[model samples]
Target: MDIKKHKIINRYYHKNCISCKSWLPATEESFYSVKKNKDGLHSYCKACVLKKAKESMLKNYDKQLERMRERNLLPGMKKAKKKYNSSLKKKKTQQIWQEKNKLKLKNYRLQRDAHKKHNITDVQWQKCKDYFNNKCAYCGLKIEDHKILFKGTYIQ
Candidate 1:
């Protein structure tokens, strides 16, 4: 008796959508899963499925609204809408306030940062400057001379 061996070839599975007739890989990335199908994937690709769903929703828009009304969800939806509008108004008011006080806010932030970095109050810094007669302690340079050299209005 003589025996013969057959070679096996590797092939990737692909399927075509019944509606669009476009070939796509038979995987979740390209197709939706259908448990009843032999390939375990939907007949239509993801894009076709989404398009069909959107069309169906638009076609049944009135029916969907009626269903939502029946379920007593309109009141909750209205409350959510009111809350969203109120939040938007609050944000707009805050933006207006910030725009009106830009210089004041900038000065407050500078003072806060200076206090944090130097651990000194504005009053203490003023008293120290007065003690030195607003001049450099080591070089005895006047505050105006130092300001010209450093290009700063005040020294820390």
Candidate 2:
């Protein structure tokens, strides 16, 4: 073996993380072992790997969401939504989000179903329309002004 390669291998083989510059015990939890590598261990420790993964996820959050949405639209994906909804992770996330925006969601539903929901009377709904001069309550932007009403709009 070359002198430099031997030194480099020796440095990381003893449970040393190249990225963190710290020494930890050689264990499956602390280091990632690769069969192809001469030392059979990754240069960076598990903590560094996790930190990198989290950073990458945050940086590509929107792109990742778009990709997942596209993937769900592929063939044989009709049951994907049902499966996702049934998952405990999805249920827990939905519960957390709903809990955080209880008042906002309630107001939204009232405005949305003014004719159906008893909490929002027709008279009160009309008054609100009059108050806003028939403009969108949330955006206040005139619908007539925007020719494309439904296009390029996010519900919530």
| Model 2, position 54: C-alpha lDDT score | 54
lDDT (C-alpha, whole model) for all candidates: 0.68, 0.64
Write down the worst ten-residue block by lDDT for model 2: 146-155
Name the regions of candidate 1 deviating beyond 4 angstroms.
1-10, 72-156
lDDT of 2 by residue, 22-121 (tens): 7665656778988876667776788798677656655665665567566684334678877777785655987887799999989988889886756877
Compose the digit string of candidate 1's lDDT tens values, residues 1-156.
Answer: 111111222575567777788766667998889899766778788888877865665566567557765654444467666676688777798568778999988999899988886577999989998999987776565677545443454456
- Candidate achieving the largest lDDT: 1
Q: What C-alpha lDDT, on a 0 to 100 scale, does residue 118 get in candidate 2? A: 63
Every candidate's CA RMSD: 27.1, 17.4
Q: Candidate 1: lDDT over CA atoms? A: 0.68
